[model samples]
Target chain A: MIICKVVGHVWATKKEEHLNGQKLMVVRETENGGGTYVAADLVGAGIGELVLVISGSTARMALGGNNTPSDMAIVGIIDNLEMETT
Target chain B: MIICKVVGHVWATKKEEHLNGQKLMVVRETENGGGTYVAADLVGAGIGELVLVISGSTARMALGGNNTPSDMAIVGIIDNLEMETT
Candidate 1:
């Protein structure tokens, strides 16, 4: 998973059948200034929260292989990131 | 899944326990001139073969949640990519 900050929410009344009622959020990847992408929200991540976004089949697994037609999923809300000193 | 072409192989005698015996291949994503990255191979894709790669938890599902410390997996060898006439 990659570190991303929730930038905004997306609303689409009509979409893939399996995606109904799921929250979609705009996320910006925190590495190398990667641009924004929409991702299905697995956790109740609010805007401005640090989150872990899992992509691909893992994103599909979020809904138990129901074919959500999305590549990214917010799997967790990161509370903190700490580093250790050598 | 994203389309990529296997470029080379990687060998690491010591790695995450779940990654033992898995084949690692270098891949270059076939979009927007993306750079190369390492991914675990699932479809026996050889160098220069266009393949589908799944990332994140989907990658972990490649090994049944064994925590393989990888973010990508070669899921299929693409025989063709056809776009219908607009």
Candidate 2:
């Protein structure tokens, strides 16, 4: 899983049939200036919210085992990050 | 799919059971200087070779779909990129 912020939305009239009704959002990784990528919203994540994104087969499994054709998906809205202060 | 260059190799004596016998390599995306990620090599790609890396369920499918835990896999070695000049 990767930590990212929901930065924007994607509106597509023509896309893969499996992508119908899926909410796509633009997410940028919070650390390391990671590249931005579109991810399906599975957890009602809002713009500017810190989210957890899962990719690959784990992404598919998150949506109940359907062939959604989505490589990435926002699975959780993170409340906070717990860090161990040494 | 993403285009990347094999920059290095990863050797592990102990790893996930599913990752056993897998060839893991460090790949850096050629375009946009994308972040580096470890990918399982499915096409016998060597260091310094430009290759195609597939992610998500596609990676698992390329390996015959036996539930490999890998999220990224080098599927092809690119000889060249064809671009059309306007």
Candidate 3:
């Protein structure tokens, strides 16, 4: 589970069968409070929200498959994310 | 399965009844190869397309769900990815 910020969204007219009617979103990967990559959205996230993204076979399971051809999925919306405050 | 590269997209209209109509994107995290995190297009990726992402609970069964809040999903679509040139 990686911590990220909602940054954008994606649109596709043609896609895989299992992907039909599914939402996608863009989230910037964060680490120690900073940015990393820019990815297409798989969740309905809005800018500024902290979110949790899952990847790999785990991502496949999130969408309910081992053959859906997906590798990432947003599975949670963090109401308030906090690290250990020293 | 976290090797990635796509770069953009996102849109929304009220959400979270299991995130009806999902799609999102953002930026980034990476190590040795460069670039780290910018996610959101649960696959159906374009741009400089080079992607592979998955996350926790196998991203909740890849969408079958352990209570469907979604952690991330984009199971697979890497026509070609290679490392090791020594």
Candidate 4:
């Protein structure tokens, strides 16, 4: 699932201890109308809205993990985005 | 896993109950040698670094559950990304 915005948030106080309670944001990838995909963000979205990111290993269960060390998250938060042009 | 590049960061408080302490970053996607596929960041990656992301229900696993409500996570940090042209 992809169609994003939320363009910013990330700060780490010496990370990797199972990511120590997580929330990260910063997405791009907007293609409901066109193209472009910027990555990074563990949900907690804002900016331009229209989000729904999830990548490999199911993004390590949305951060809870394949032992932390995240891949991607931001499960949902899209009011409306439909594309099925045949 | 996709080839990626992070150009920045994000920060927030009073987000979703499940999205308490995480980090974010954004940018347009990059191919190993060609294409473009910018998406969000979930891993603790740095500028110009390659990372791996997981999506979907399994993304739920990377986090903790389908309950916490996330969809992606950084599954691995890529050291190499190779694509073959047919």
Candidate 5:
């Protein structure tokens, strides 16, 4: 999973039928200035929250096998990341 | 799906049991000098072929829902890509 921050929302009145009712968000990877991509919200993640995203086909699995043509999905809301001072 | 060229192969004898019997190949995205990632080969793609890859959980779907921890899989071989000259 990649770390991302919910930046904004994406809406379309007409789109793929399977994509209806899906909440789309614009997210940018948290590290290294990764490019942004549209992701479906699986968890109730909010804007500016750190989220865990699983992309590609794994993302579609979150839609109950809907095959929505989306390649990214927010999978979790991360609380923190602690590193060991080794 | 991303277009990539097969650069090399990876082998791990000891790994998640679910990952056993999976063939791993190193791929470089065709458009950008995108960093490499290990991808499971679903098609019998060769070393020099340009391939279409579906990554993340979609990759695991190629494994029959085994939930194999893989994140990328080669979905097709690219024979031609035609674009209109406008």
Candidate 6:
């Protein structure tokens, strides 16, 4: 999992049937500045909120089963993230 | 999953027991330059080779079972990747 900032929404009506009823949001990596990618939202994340993103099979499993075609998902809304400065 | 370029190797003698005997290679996203991350190599990929990477539960499944603690994996060596620029 990684920390990301919810940047935008992806409104897709013509998408995979498995993705129906799922909320898709664009998130950018907070720590590494990894470019934005679309992720299914489970935590009702608002734009500009810092969130925790998980990818792969874990993503699909989190959505209830392995039928969903999600490769990434917002699993948590982070309240605080502490990092030590070296 | 996405296409990435193998840039280097990760030599770790002390790692998760499930990771033993697995080859870990560092990959950088090819198109987006999404920076670098380490992935277990499923295919025989070498440095500078373009490969297909999969993450999350799919990675752990590809490694064999749920016992492996892998989140990313190199699944294929790309012979070619075609994209049309608009």
- Model 3 residue A36 CA deviation (Å) reads 5.4
| Model 6 lDDT tens row, A26-75 | 67786764655667899899988999998876787897775565577899
TM-score of 3: 0.46
Candidate 2 lDDT over residue span B1-86, tens digit each: 45578999989887878888889999998654567999888668889987766576756655546578887877656654432111
Per-residue error for A58 in candidate 6, Å, reads 0.5
Query: In lDDT terms, how accurate is model 6?
Result: 0.74
Candidate 6 residue B86 Cα shift, in angstroms, is 23
Taking all chains together, each candidate's TM-score versus the true structure is 0.53, 0.53, 0.46, 0.44, 0.52, 0.53
Off by over 4 Å in 1: A83-86, B1-58, B66-86
> What digit string (tens of lDDT, one per residue) describes model 4 on residues B1-86?
55445544433333335644544444324554432233334566775676665556665556665544445455566787777866
Each model's number of backbone clashes? 1, 1, 101, 63, 4, 2
User: Which scores better on DockQ, 1 or 4?
Assistant: 4
Q: What is the lDDT of candidate 2?
A: 0.72
Worst 10 residues of 3 chain A by lDDT: A32-41
Write down the worst ten-residue block by lDDT for model 1 chain A: A77-86
- List the DockQ of the predictions in order: 0.08, 0.08, 0.08, 0.09, 0.07, 0.09
For model 2 the TM-score comes to 0.53
Per-residue CA lDDT of candidate 3, range B1-86, in tens?
Answer: 45556566655576566655555554332333565443445547766665555555554545565665666555434454332211
How well is each residue in A1-86 modelled by candidate 2, as lDDT tens digits? 89988877655443334556877776778775565666779999998899999887677667556455556789999998996645
Candidate closer to the true structure by TM-score (higher is better), 4 or 5: 5
Residue B17 of model 3, lDDT score: 68
Worst 10 residues of 4 chain B by lDDT: B32-41
> A62 in model 6: Cα distance from truth in Å?
0.2
Tens-place lDDT per residue, model 3, A36-82, is 33333455666678888776666666766664545667778788776
